[model samples]
Target: MLRGLTTVSHFSDDVPAAVAWYAELLGIEPYFQREVQGKLAYVEFRLGDYQHELGILDRRFAPPGAGTPGGTMTYWAVDDVEATYQRLLDLGGTAQQSPTEHGPGFVTASVIDPFGNQLGVMFNQHYLDVFTGRPA
Candidate 1:
């Protein structure tokens, strides 16, 4: 059995600026900002009911051999993938993939944030039905 997601983390050169942009994108301000280990680092913000943390650290602090804009990507499921994708575009996000059907009643799209972080918008009526114990 899988537990619910706890948090998603992203690395940024400028923590404050990243937080602000994300806040605007998500329409929520950070709930916590604090320094860690003698350096200005880490901010956590809520998205819907989930928590996302962004870390600000020196280049050397990056994971071993992790290049800038590491290939890691995060997808956030939304009720309306197309609308969310367009809203992100209007908010200055770079579109990576226009909305398209992925499977039976499933649609998805993606965009790159100002900081080069890829954000995906997804919708799956089947998955929703399964999770809610309803017929698809």
Candidate 2:
């Protein structure tokens, strides 16, 4: 049974550029990196209140025909979905979906990163409640 998210891996043709882009967006460098045969192959950043892992893996390791954008959409919790979405657009990400209110305490947005990965942001009251150790 799936318990919780451990790592979210994104494929990138240019690992270094992906790492730099993510570092800038996260405002911190990756805490860990790995090289395969002297070539950078992966980088991992620990972010958010839970310190979840965000991983950038060399596209060469991706599954067959997985280069195109379209797959699992992982939404990271944010304080301001609109502001975060705008920041992503300013950072060279293409908007996939503008900020939209799903219901009373939930707003969501998505963007396609420069490396062809979809990144989602959300402001969810339930997530905040659980994060704060309050009843969801």
Candidate 3:
């Protein structure tokens, strides 16, 4: 019933700023966007070797009863967890968790973006193995 990771999304109150911030972080502009009367409402970016989708939707578009921006987090793969974590902070994200190794080579970190969404990052051997077709 499950295929694979398809998309990871976040909410933003300011579309242009969020788009600019992620464009800098990912080094690519969003490939898809929806606008209402010339105002961006939603945007998507394809990233990584897997071409995983990252969506940023306006917070107003969220379902009813969704109060704040904390929920299931999807950790993105990065070459350097520590450096990426710091870079997120340097780009105005606040720290949620410092990078830490979790035995047997798994390392993860978390940060709250300027838009109040939680963004996670990791340096994973399994991801590299799967991406490169190498044994983990």
Candidate 4:
């Protein structure tokens, strides 16, 4: 059976630049990196309460049909969707979706990073409840 997410990977034509961009956005440098054929091939950062892995891979190793920047979007939990969306924009991410409310307790936003990956942020009551051990 499928389990929780362990790593989220994004591809970039320039791995070093992507790593630098993400480092600035996250306010931390990658904890690990790998090189292939004397060229930087990948870098990874551990983040979030559970230390989820965010990886940037050199596009040269991507699969044949994986040239496109995005497909399915994965939303990360945030305390404030609007603030996070604004921060992403300030970090040079292009706006894809402005903060929008869904139902009573869910707000979501998305952006396209300079590397062309879709990064989503959400303020969800359920996530906050679980994270804070509070009843919803």
- Cand. 2 Cα-lDDT: 0.93
Range of the 10 consecutive residues with the lowest summed lDDT in candidate 2: 63-72
* Residue-level lDDT tens digits of model 2 in 26-55: 999999999999989999999998899999
Query: What digit string (tens of lDDT, one per residue) describes model 4 on residues 52-134?
Result: 99999998887775635466888998888998899999989999999999989999999999988889999889977777794
- lDDT per residue as tens, model 3, 1-136: 9999997778788988999999998899999999987889999999998799999888888776442556677899999999999999999999999999997768999998898888999999998878788444
lDDT of 1 by residue, 1-136 (tens): 8776666666566766777777887787777777767664777776642344434333335666443444765667688888899999998889899999977878888887766666777887865676688445
Candidate 2 backbone collisions, by pair: none
What's every prediction's RMSD, in angstroms?
3.9, 2.0, 2.4, 2.5
User: TM-score-based ranking, best first?
Assistant: 2, 3, 4, 1
Which candidate tops lDDT?
2
Q: In terms of TM-score, which candidate is stronger, 1 or 2? A: 2
Question: lDDT, candidate 3, residue 36?
Answer: 81
Off by over 4 Å in 2: 134-136
Off by over 4 Å in 3: 65-69, 134-136
TM-score of 2: 0.94
